[model samples]
Target: MRQTWRWFGPRDLVSIDAVRQAGAEGIVTALHHVPTGTVWSPAEIEQRKREIATMKDGSPSTLTWDVVESLPVSEDIKKQSGDWRAHIAAYKQSLRNLSDAGIGVICYNFMPVLDWTRTDLAWRLPTGGTCMRFDLTDFAAFDIFILERPGADADFPEEVRAAASARLAGMDGARQERLARNVVFGLPGAAESFTLEDVRRHLAEYAPLGADGLRANMAAFLEEVAPLAQELGLRLCCHPDDPPFSLLGLPRIMSTEADYTWLINAVDLPANGITLCSGSLGARPDNDLPGMMKRLGDRVHFLHLRNVRRETAGIPCSFHEAEHLGGGTDMVALVRAALAEEARRRVAGRADASIPFRPDHGQDILDDLGRQAQPGYPSIGRLKGLAELRGIIAAETHAG
Candidate 1:
């Protein structure tokens, strides 16, 4: 695998120099300052490239902006509503500009409303480290009592609703507000930011679009974009829905292998691919990480290699980010599978043989405890994860 790190532009607390020190060969980033559905001017793209390529001393950092974490598909495009056609044109233009700039892979998600949902930003662990977590009862409390969405009661089981009521009752004003904020926090540096009102309004817009409708819309969007990606020699990968399930009554179209199979076949383009986020898909007990990698390896363009430990066997059960190798995933088996895939690609002379993968999220430990870096992206924690992954890769290569 080609090791990479995600940087949120100049505003990110984790600097490029720090990423270099962490031993990442490439940067996975985007024009986060640009709003959604807007064109990324070549000047802006060049400026970001210069920022990543040049150090503070006007010397070369020797780091390339190899992958764009997202060029951001607009919500309008997702629903095929107002201005969606315009947004699609802008998206194609962005891809052309990126290809001209020598950036080849783009990672985007089709999840409605929120990108990735978590109930807590910094849940404490037994080791005194803090990691992101999703508590079923806490989320139900937010969905049922706090947001007060219409028909929210019908979404959860009666027992879950009862527990949520108790959970909400124990919370004072400040706690209740905190829970709401965390749920809608959105991506750390992306254009989407939401309040309770914004979320509720968006939910209303998606009320009629169930899983089938959303999936069809996504297919339509891809039909337009995937052909363009192929023409421009760009790889476009859709990230799996985080937690891989329905949330807040929103339809989750890209969650399971069946979903991927349908989308891959629907678009029927090689450039249309998967991001293969282990932690997100692994949240569901039914997903087999190594099996998915082995079966879907040919279509995987980017990778987020992290792990999660489920608290129970059920879907939508509570879970927290665990150490890379300590979670429910078989890290060793998954790593071996990735290596095997790369070997196959090399033999076939594929251009993207060594997939670009980043050490996704990490626990807040050591210097990260007080650095106030973005949630789940603490510098030291990720360094530890990269080091561990590096060791595994080295050992696997040697053994092979």
Candidate 2:
């Protein structure tokens, strides 16, 4: 696996120098300032690359802006509503521009309403500093008590509603508001976020388009763009739905292996692939990570490794920033599988040999409290994760 760190360009508090200090040679980033549905110009791509190349410390490490976390799908395109063709064309143009710059992988998600949901952004960790986690009780408290969206009460069970009501009753207005922001406010790089009103409006857009409609939109987008990806030698990897389930009555098309199978089959192109996210898929016990890897390993272009402790009720899961080898996932097996897949790719003479792998969702620890970086992007924690993963990969290489 080729180790890379996600650097959110010049504005990111975690600098390229810091990423180099963390011992990563590659970078996974995007032209974030570029608006959704707009084509990224070649000049813009070159400028971002030059900026990354010229880090403050002048480290000689190579920076490949290969992985784009997301190239936002406009509401027009997602709903297949008016003027979607324009957005689709713009998206294809962006793909061409990115590919022209030699970017290899593009990671995007097809979730309807939300990207990743976290009930608490500053969830305290035992070692100090905060990590992101989804608390069911917190969400329940929000749904049943705070946002008070119509039909929200029906989303939860009777017992959950009682717990939520009790929790809500104890909170004041300020705490409730914070909880709502944490749940819905878009994290950095998450497409367009929603206000409580915005969320409802977004849901209205999807009301006419259920699971099938959303899938069709995704397929249509891929059909239009995947060929351009193949032409430009770029692999388009769609991230699975974050929680791996439906939320707020929104359709989740990428939650299961069946969804992945349908997606790859729809396009039948190597450029169309999946970003295997352990944290997201691991939230659901039914998903066999290793099995999915074996079945779809050929199409797995990128990997997000993190862990979550599933709650019994299935609504909330405690996301722990575990050491790469300490999480619920079978890291060793997964690494071996990934290595085997890469080996197969090499055997088949694939040009991009090193698969871009990053330690996803690190815990906030050490001096990260005052660093003013993106949440869950603490440098030390991710450094620890990368070190652990590197060790695991080394052992796997030796054993093989």
Evaluate model 1: give its TM-score. Answer: 0.98
lDDT of candidate 1 over 107-192, digit per residue (tens): 99999999999999999999999999999999999998889989889988888899999998999999999999889988879866
> What local lDDT score does residue 125 receive in model 2, on the 0 to 100 scale?
64
Clash counts per candidate, in order, are: 0, 0
Per-residue lDDT of candidate 2, residues 1-400 (tens digit): 8888888888888888888788887888877777777887999889888877876866554666768877777778889887789889988888888877887799988877677788887778666767777777778788766766777778777887888788888889898889999888664754456789888788777887899899888888888988889888889998988788777778888988999999999999999999999888887777888888888998998988776666464543445445556656787788888888889989999876578889887777788777857877888878888888898889888855
Cα error, candidate 2, residue 71 (Å): 1.5
Best by lDDT: 1
Question: In order, what is each prediction's RMSD in angstroms?
Answer: 1.0, 1.9
The deviation in Å at residue 14 for candidate 1 is: 0.6
Worst 10 residues of 2 by lDDT: 313-322
